[model samples]
Each structure stands twice: as structure tokens, then as C-alpha cells.
Target: MVASSLISTNFLFSSPLFPPRSPIRKLTIVSLHKIPTPSSSHVKPHKRSLLPCRPLCPPCLNKLLLTTRNPFSFALDSLLILCTSLALSLSLLVADVDSASAFVVTPQRKLQTDELATVRLFQENTPSVVYITNLAARQDAFTLDVFEVPQGSGSGFVWDKGGNIVTNYHVIRGASDLRVTLADQSTFDAKVVGFDQDKDVAVLHVDAPKDKLRPIPIGVSADLLVGQKVFAIGNPFGLDHTLTTGVISGLRREISSAATGRPIQDVIQTDAAINPGNSGGPLLDSAGSLIGINTAIYSPSGASSGVGFSIPVDTVNGIVDQLVKFGKVTRPILGIKFAPDQSVEQLGVSGVLVLDAPANGPAGKAGLLPTKRDSYGRLILGDIITSVNGKKVTNGSDLYRILDQCHVGDKVIVEVLRGDQKEKIPVVLEPKADES
Candidate 1:
């Protein structure tokens, strides 16, 4: 390789690039060489020789270039080539050695404080959590064979070793058949013992063996504080028992009942994930005790969006006790039908307008007036209840709320607006025949 400014190093030995052998050393200096073009007028007219200046006696990097026939230069180049080939072979071997054993696994370590506690909580409580499947009867399109198919799913907890279970009312709603599955994968047929649509609480009885029933520890939600840690366990999306952790985001939340469309007061609000199938699952506090029942979520897509409502355990205890003993919620009734809140509002009235007071009912026995039609085909307004006892009554909800706190046979003052005067009448509450 002979060129200007580069030592013609050995054209002395056969070149792997330039070829042939010459006694003299030769080398190329390609960086300094530029062919002159006639089209470029700025080009210098004087031309330099290809080998402008001598580089060195042996040439630049002679051993690496193998420009000389010296034994040392030849030997050095051969050794370098052998090392490169060996490195490439080793790289190929490593690329092909992708076996599972090559990936070293780190040894297991002890669980963290919070992690261990959570793990224990789930393990101890899982036996109490049960899966519920709401079944619907479906007829085969072609065969016309009728069979029961799963329509929906939710979660529940064991109420006692007597095979009694507690869940949300909406969970088993509209079911043609119901099934309850225990934590051990054992299933049992379930029957509805009692339910309260207004409070959205339902009690189911399963005949599983006593050994499979593990009653959950009950806790009061009345003393729960916001920002306290909470846990939710349920079979969301028909999956197995899953655990979600969050804090009590709010307290004393009021939400409407899904079945009765009535207001459930003092509800618990949490951010723990509550999805479609988590309706009847228990919401536990940090102590792994049941605090509330996960009910509804505030999401547009029917998925969890952080906002969830739970029926408070304090309220649930009373309802469950009544249901377990009587198989129904026994509450005193006024034995009268009243106008809707919207209708009373439309009449510019601020009280519940008595629609009907049956002659055999308590309201009629107390001398309460009822709306009627006259011979002239004209409507006559009756007594408009202004309050029950001393509490103000503005709507049907208010009246129901007040009466729910009262008992049967309890005498109370019922204020009414009859014509242009106000009168207070004493009425004894009576139990509804169905509830009785």
C-alpha cells in the first residue's frame, strides 16, 4: 500500500490487501490524496507525488498491518486473529446457552410487617367468605330443554354454624335458583330465610356441614373514623376470593335502596374496590372484623370508580336479628296510604296528604280524614299530616323515617291540616298484617 506521506512499508511481504511481494516497504496515505478536476478553477495546478513523504523505516503500525516479513510481526498478527476468532466463538456459545438453569433465582425472604398481617387476615377470614350464584331458568333454543343457568354472582359470609348466611338483598334478586359455595370449593343449595328490600339486607340459609361454616367476627361501624384502613374481600367478576385495601373515605353517607327505592341513612363510604359481583361481600376493618356490607358503587360504566357505599353493621345488626327470629322485618305501620311526595309538592303543600284511611285501619279509627269524591263529581281534600309526634314531616320519606323509629301500640300525636285549621290527633300504631 504505497501512497503520498505514507511509508512504503514492505511491499516487502505479501499483502492480504495490496497483493504481491517486494523487497521495499510501502504504505498508502489515502487521507491526503485528492484528484484534481478541471471543472474546479480553485484547484492548484502543481501536483504532488503519490508518496509525498517517508513515514518511518518500518511503517505505521507495521506489526498490525503485517507489512514486513519479520517473524515477530507475522506472529503478532496471527495471535491477534486467533484471539478475535476465540472471542466470537465464545459469544456465539453464550447466545446459544439460554437455558432456565442459567437464570439464578434469589432465595425467599420473610414477609414484611404489613404484608404478613394482611396475609394472615385474608387466610383467617377466607373460610367465612362464600360465593353466591344467582341462577335463572333458560330453555334451549333447539332442543327445548329447560335448565338452570347462572345469571349473576356475588359474595356472602356465614352468619352462624346453623348454615345461616347474610348477604345483600340485590344479590339474590330475581333468581329462579340460588347456590352458595364455601371456601373449600364445596357447594350447597340455599334458601331465602328473610330479606329487607329497604335496607338491602338478606339472610340465606345453606345446609352445608358445620365443619365448613366459619362465622365472621362482627364489628360496629358506628365508631368507624374516616381515613382508617379498610379491607374488602369478594369474588369480583366471578373470580375467586380477591382482597382490596383502602381507607374509609367518608362516613354517614346516605344512599337509596336498590329494591325499595327508599333512603338508607348512616351508610358507610369507602374507596375499596367494589365491583358488580362484590355487592354482598363484607367490608372489614384493620382488625379483620366485619364493619359493613359492600353494596353499591358510583361509576358510569358499572365498574369501580373509587366511590362505594356499604350498609353499616350497626344498622344491619337490628335488621338481621329481626329477620333471624321472625323471618321478616316487623315494623309498626300507620295503616294508611298517602300521596306521593311529588304530588304533594305540586299541590303547593308542605305535608303528606292522606290519600286513603281505610275504615278498618288505625288512621280511620283515630278520626283522621281521607280524600274523597262528592256527588257533584268534585274532589275533596282530606287531612294533610304536618308532623308525627314533634318531628316535622315534609314528605313521604320523612314520615316513613319518623315512623320507623316508633313501635306498635305506641300512641303519638299526629298533626293535620284540615280545611283552615290545625288539629292534633292521637293514634295507636298497628302492625301490618303481612309483617305480623
Candidate 2:
């Protein structure tokens, strides 16, 4: 009877009506009930109890018996265990999600002063920048139809609302036709207005609407200081209106012109990344004012090497004005030819050796003599120009530079060295003859 009662209790513990305790706890309770009773027939039943026990009533015994006979009791226990495990896993996932959401971070944003200024400058000046394309005419071999083919591309800036654009002369040189693309991507056919080959500056005009034109604000390059901030806006590598920032690396630098083979004086040297397609673009000051025109860079691989040169706007302003007025530079001349600098140096001469002076020219009229060969075939040296108006003329370039400062019909005193004697004679300047 006791063994049958223990079996009934085991089944009752596994039923769904009772709480689903662990199998170990259930086994512990069953072992307690099965504690051995003392083998004493004379002892009273209550006094001989091995352990304290709750009396099993008839209703409890009946329920335990019925649970033992049920066949689905084992399946019910397994279902309860699986549901509990699933609930525990879902609760852990929810906790992790909540923790992650509570500690989320967002980045803060701030604007720098220099960066803001650069942005403003680009916005204001980009409209004045333009892209120029050089085109050459090629005729089809079969149809004889001519079409303009792309030769090269570079950058330029609008000079005025009248559609006058300024760029490097080499940018448009040898092109049969030209096109200008504005910042808005609108293109127009450009006609050559004027060009100064010696300065490497060219002016072009397009029939663009006045409202579409934006002229770059002019700045004085003469007062520019080294280390001052500079900006460049150009179509670098055919990429339109690209902005590059740098400081003025040097001043009064000289670069040879690609168009005329003459030295460009007072060039502004910068570290701004000027490349091939940037040739005619404007170099601006920090205040968004046009300071110079990017012309060349010193590089062996035909790329920027951080040594870029710009034609100073101070020189550009005067040249452009003259070009627009006369379609050519009206340079003043002394009407005298000199021996080459190399030849003069070999002769150990310190001054420009006068090779010839036209009989009807200003120098000849002023009684300046030229070198000649005597009847005996011995070379005879004439007057050598030593200075002009007190400025020393060491070579032909110095003489030309001094004459450039004078205008036509201006009277200047010319000092020449004749043998061991120095003479100062006054001569009037004249316009240079057009070789074209």
C-alpha cells in the first residue's frame, strides 16, 4: 500500500494543475515520503513515525490515483519546459535592444571661420570664371566638309559686361575658332578682340547676354605682400571653375612668355596648384579681388610643381587697356639696333653696343654713331649706350625697359660711351614699327 501511494504521488507532481517544479526537487520530496519506518510492533503508530507527514485524505488519494493512470502526463510536462525556455530567450533579446537604444550617440557640427570665408569667396567669384576651348578647322577627305575639331582647352575670366574675356595668349594661339563656356554651362562662340603676345595676354569677345556676364573685381598687384593669402579659380584639367587656395610665395618674379619669348616682368609667384588648363584663369586675393592671371608653372613633367607664376594684374590692366584701344601694343622705340648681348659680352662691353642707327631715325638724328668696318677691314666701334636719363642700360633688355616707360614724342637724354669719352645727347622717342 505504501509503494502504491508513492507512485500515485509521483504522477500528481507531474500534472499540469500543479506548478512545474524541477525534477530534482520532485525527487527530493518523494524520497522524504519514502523514509523507512522503525520495525517495532509494540511501539504506538504515532510515536514510531520516522518523519513528520501530512495525513493523506481520501480526496487527495483519489486525485493522485487518477493522475497516475493518465497517459498524456509526460507530454504535458515537456510542452511546459519548452514554453518556459522560449519566454526566457525572448526576454533577454528585448533587454539588449533597450540598452542599445538608451546609449545612442549623435555627432555635433561646427563651422570654421577660414573655411566659411573660402566658401563665400568661391560663391561670389565663380560666376566670373569661364572655360575656353581652342578649335582647329579640318576638312573631310571625301566630302570636303570642314568642321572645327578640338585643339585644347583652358580657363579665362570675364573682363566686362560687354562680353570681353581675358586669357593667356597661348591658350587661344593657333586656333582657327574658339568657344567660351560660362559658369552656367552656357556656351558661346568667341571672336578674337586683341592680344599682347609679349605679355601673353589675349582678350576675346562673345555675344553673351549682358546679364549673364560677371566681371571679376580688380585688385592692385603692386601693393601685394608676400605670404598674403591668394586664391585661384580655373578649369584645371578641363574641370570647370575649380578653386585652389594658397599664399603668395614670392613677388617681382620673371617668367618667359610662351608666345613672344620675352621675359614677363613683375610676375607673381605662388604655390597655388596652377596646371596646363589653368593658363588663363584669374588669381584672386583673399578679398575675392582679381590680383593676377595664372600663366605658367615650373615642372619637368608638364604638371604643377608648386612653383606657379602669374602675370600681375597691375601689368595686365595697362596691357589690356592698350590692347583694347589699339588691337596691338604701342610700344615706344629708340630706332636703334644693338649687337646681340652674347656678342657684346664677348667683346667685354658693359653697355649695349650700337650696331646700326637708321639715318632718318631719332638716334641717328641725335648724332649717335654706329659700329662700322674700315677700308682696311678692321672693325671700328661706335658709340655704346651706357644709360638713358640716368638709368643704367647694361644690355638691350635694359634699354627696352627704359624706353617702355616713355611715350611717343617724349624727349629723353641718352648717355653713350664713345671710346674713352661719355656724351649725353637728347633724343625723342618714337612708336615701334609693326613687323606684321
Cα RMSD, each candidate: 12.9, 10.1
**True-vs-predicted CA distance for residue 343, candidate 1, Å:** 2.9
* Local accuracy of candidate 2 as per-residue lDDT tens digits, 66-96: 4454557556765665565455556666776
lDDT of 1: 0.85
Error of 2 at 236 (Å): 1.8
Error of 2 at 333 (Å): 1.6
Number of colliding residue pairs in each model: 12, 0
Query: Could you tell me how far off, in angstroms, the CA of residue 107 lies in candidate 1 after the best superposition?
Result: 6.1
Estimate the TM-score of every prediction: 0.72, 0.72
- Local distance difference test, per candidate? 0.85, 0.84
